[model samples]
Target: MSTNTPAPVGSSGKGASLARMGVFTLAMINVSAIVSLRGLPAEATYGLSSAFYYIFAAIFFLIPVSLVAAELTTGWPQKGGVFRWVGEAFGTRLGFLAIWLQWIESTIWFPTVLTFAAVSLAFIGPDQRWDEAVSANKWYVLAIVLAVYWSATLLNFKGMRTSAGITKWGTMIGTVIPGALLIVFGLIYWGSGNKVDINMAPGNFFPDLTNFNNIVLAASIFLFYAGMEMSAVHVKDVKNPGRNYPMAILIASLITVGIFVLGTLAIGYIIPEAQINLVQSLLIAFDKFFTIFHITWLGPVMAVCLACGVLAQVVAWVGGPSKGLLQVGYAGYLPRAMQKTNKKGVQTGILFIQGGIVTILSVMFVIMPSVQSAYQIISQLTIILYLIMYMLMFAAGIALRHKEPNVPRTFRIPGGKHFGMWLVAGVGLLGSVIAFLFSFVPPDQISVGSPTLYVVILLLGAVIFAGIPFLIYAMKKPSWKNTDSANEFEPFNWELKKTNTETSAPAPEQQH
Candidate 1:
């Protein structure tokens, strides 16, 4: 039986430790990585039916991704996350595409989340209208987004310890505490005999699936769960990965889903369906709850927390996918200039390039017809790019099952061999494809201007971003690899097999 040995956690010999992370720490990392409370109000617009979307997405996308990623991570506990896994199944070219999508999607995603953070910061003011004015000011939002994102990028340049510390504390202060408080206040509102705005009728639990446009916003829920697979990259860092990894995933998934469901319901219970604002409702709900509970001062406090949470999230992601792509670059897929690292061993070249893309995307606030339109366009594009990568990942999981069946997996997905792999990865792929298709059908909730223009931009963005990696792969030169780099990304298993086959074959008639 063949087994891929796990690499040391802090393998870079720069005083990094090999200490393993505990299950709780790993679970919190997953929660911090996955949960974002800002999007709850948008989902809350569906009333009680929002529960159905949350649960449906969790089943079809969340659990399957977590489990499948756990198996893949444990099977090959290397540096590159999706890039390493997918490349092993397909080849280096497509593998580079997978990591590229991961990095670039997050690059596009920064502006959207930062927009939420900008709105959150605006709400810190006492006057609602003034806050709304600030939030709506495109230049104001653009300036704050660039400032916060660049700050996070600079902090990340220091190294992982600094980045991870911010992510941990930021999650607790910004996400977990605020989420729990929202749920608590929701319970108080219901228990205090207050009239709930949402329909609690059992019949309303399921969403209207007949109207495709009605469910378009629900498609965004898939993006809410996007970063869970990212946490899987750390599976090998946890002690007893085979046993503890699943435990961590289970705990994290339950916590993540609970926060999402109850948080959305909390907003639905307070804000009327028609009045829910995609960016403002979350804060407004907090304000309303605080007012009723006679703790109105907490509103601004929660706003600060949410803004910090957004920064922490950006901090965590700013370092993650880029680091993976850096590994891909070292594997000869990217030009050597892109592979340069700082003295801190951080990917300086890639970080700067990523920041440049972010700056350009942030500028869309001025060019797009409205701030909301810009938000929707970039958000939809992010969803499409990420879903494309996910499709490749799901397909890779199943392909690896056939190609490397004998490779021992410490945390195999439950069920018979082929059935387990197929069932888990298949559901994830189907959900991703469905979400990808619906993302093109402009959301009914927002004013995205021209529907034709929206579709064209999404298609064009998807093709262009997805095509760039292939272009780089075709243009790759042997000199693009940095031999001086201490960390050497492993060759794909197929490449090794082909090499072994050729080496063992009889020499060409010796040309004697």
Candidate 2:
């Protein structure tokens, strides 16, 4: 049976073929992956020593993930992005799970970041006691964050044109400016001969091989660097993805790692680990670092900038994954309500649902003793979901070689097909497994939650979230395929059509 459902189309009519993206745009996206490196309150506790783990993570985790994504993305530059790539390699059910996990994780992370932004701003308010009160109040923090987050969501509802405008300009104003300011402030502080605690010495910059715990810490921090591939979803929009994709990933990786190495060093120089506000450490570093340099005026300026950056981060995430999952939903994996889009091309329902999820998770903060504990728990759950997505990606990449042997590939991994498959799939599988295992280990700096609770929360999160896709798959019924529906939203169009003449004549020989 042919279902005549019109496929939901995203901006149709291909724009001009993209030329190679230069270092600037590449750096912008890369910065998106690494900007969260600042403050890193968790890392600060091990003294200046944890910076080494970050460097290691940049090497083993971040770069390889980017490379794997570049290959997959260059091969299949389609609307669905990761969901399509993985679904093509695996089946639709698994693909739905990939996007679902990605979308869900972002929802969980929204509150933690907002709280971090709130805490950062609170420090600058007059009266330390009042500052403490505002920072500690869960309801107040939730209200402020929800307000900012929902506003950004509304802006995104205006469509990609508006969202892209904000993202492009916001990245510059929010991230690059603040980052450059940090570097400039650090130089000024050093030139003035102020005593700085964190060592920027050449030897300290190198990875410490002897410390196993620090190695694990780097592995933990490395997970934060996991989103490089997420930006690659836009590779098709880049002028010439083949060359530009690799170039972008390479340049972005270096710039991102450099910023992280330098930024962390600067933070360490200014503050001791014990005094670090793991929640708002980056702003804390700015406050203290600016004070030491006698540039108190810059402190509040940086704080506002940091808050805007966090807000922009929330805005970008609020729309991005939901957009991906909306693709899956409209394709019949989800109900029709999820398919609804307003005039601005936003899935308002999904946005509202995401906010609701975040609001629910925000309540967890009240039960949890500390913001860091709640933040870590939520982030860990996100990591678990992310790992499941990565595992599917790896499997899909490998499956494609066998299933579509002659499919045109613009940018194949350098090795022979088998070698390439093994390398990409193997590394992805290993890194994801390691990341999942490490997700349960409580951070060393603070006792945010008990080990028993942490393990249970993480395990339950992974199982329950990951199980949703399977349930959907089991509910699916086979139907006639529609060639026109190759990338359409309806799965009923996916069933192959049968001809009446062939059906009538089919059993003649068997009867004789």
Candidate 3:
């Protein structure tokens, strides 16, 4: 969270110490927080080239985000995670946009993720045809998405301990175990005499760079590596903040990339590229693998695990951004209503409003032709907004290096102070720019119904969603400050400087 705490994700307190924490535990937490089977099928469509995208995204985007965010977190160390980081570099308004994009992207992300859970739930039965048909039904998907999302949202009202349990168990059972099984099953199938579906030639390792639509879909692969920024705060938890921190991050990166690359290859090896259905292909691949091994009952069990994982992920994410938004609201960016919390200090008003937005966006399932297409459309929009936020975050990192060079960061990006910042943040910014531009182009891989409507959804969603924050920032009143005595959000450094300069200024006669 922009608030710079893990409690929003899993922990109920600030963080733990090296006595109870180690490199491996931190690495696995990064793995479980980030690794998801829902996205394997999308990358699998690229066959051997999927490995390239995953590695590329990790180097240019994933590692840089964690590194840059770590620097920003230490430098600013303010309550508003992104809001504090960006506002310190730019101003409160752009800072507001940064946090808004994060919150909105996550809100839009729920239904798409839950769509996978819906499909997982639908495919829990042994009959493939019936399961596929049911998963494709928009109404069924919608009902499951709403029901499950609402359940997670409601559970959030109970506070962090409840969701933490769901996230912990869900990540292991749903993601880790299933991901291992997928790779093992693929190796087993390959070890036996089973035929491979995708081309294994070295030439197939690189995608057609000229194909704009191909890159458009591949742009989404950047997001698959998202959410590792949480690891940055753990730098202090390990023995050597310098050595062990980067090592843990590197190990986690390798593990995360390994799971993604191997898992994607596993799916592509079995399912023909043409037969890949974003919503159903993962479940189908599992069932196919089980059928080959003559143990078909595990298909439903895998679905249950995957569905639970997605649901648990929803529970984990439900309140994080909203809480950041809530903190910002307390600082006077949002209405009093949105700033309200329940007895548990949960951001109920914002959560309820987020749920409403999700309910509306979930309708895209019906408006688009198929579940995959709808998923693709919404996903494209999510990437665009998120990439914009990333671009701002990256640029903010660079800007602050120049603007506040003496701020005494606990961790630096490594190289020279300024040059290293440039190298890392620049790469992240460039990658984000490329992906941001490509997100507007509709992918040829999925049927998005109307290209015009698809573009409209992307353009309008980006413009309107990004535009809303400035409107709220402009509308904020001085009286909007946090009413709570204990949790008064800190003012931005610029805000304090402006006050100081004003205080030191002379009267008109005195100045003359």
Position 394, candidate 1: lDDT = 94
Q: How high is the CA lDDT of each candidate model?
A: 0.83, 0.67, 0.84
Give the worst 10-residue stretch by lDDT in candidate 1: 1-10
Output the lDDT of residue 128, model 3. 95
How many backbone clashes can be found in candidate 2?
A: 12
Q: Over the stretch 211-263, how does candidate 2's per-residue lDDT look in tens digits?
A: 54444434456556767776554555565565666677767667766766666
Residue runs of model 3 more than 4 Å from their true location after superposition: 1-16, 504-512
lDDT of 2: 0.67
lDDT of 3 by residue, 1-512 (tens): 11112322333345556566787877766666577788889888899999989998898898899889878877887688888888899998899999999899999988899999999999987699999999999999999999999999999999988888887788778877998999999988887867899788999888888866667788898888776665566655556656666777899889889988988989998999999998899999999999988999899999999898878778878977788888888888888888889999999989988999999999988888888898998888888888988888999999999988888777778888689999999999999898888888888888888889889888999999999888888888878787777878888777888899999998677554
TM-score of 3: 0.95
Which pairs, if any, clash in model 1? none
Supply the TM-score for candidate 1: 0.92
Q: Model 2: what TM-score?
A: 0.85
Residue-pair clash count for candidate 3: 2
Count of clashes, each model:
0, 12, 2
Off by over 4 Å in 1: 1-29, 233-248, 510-512
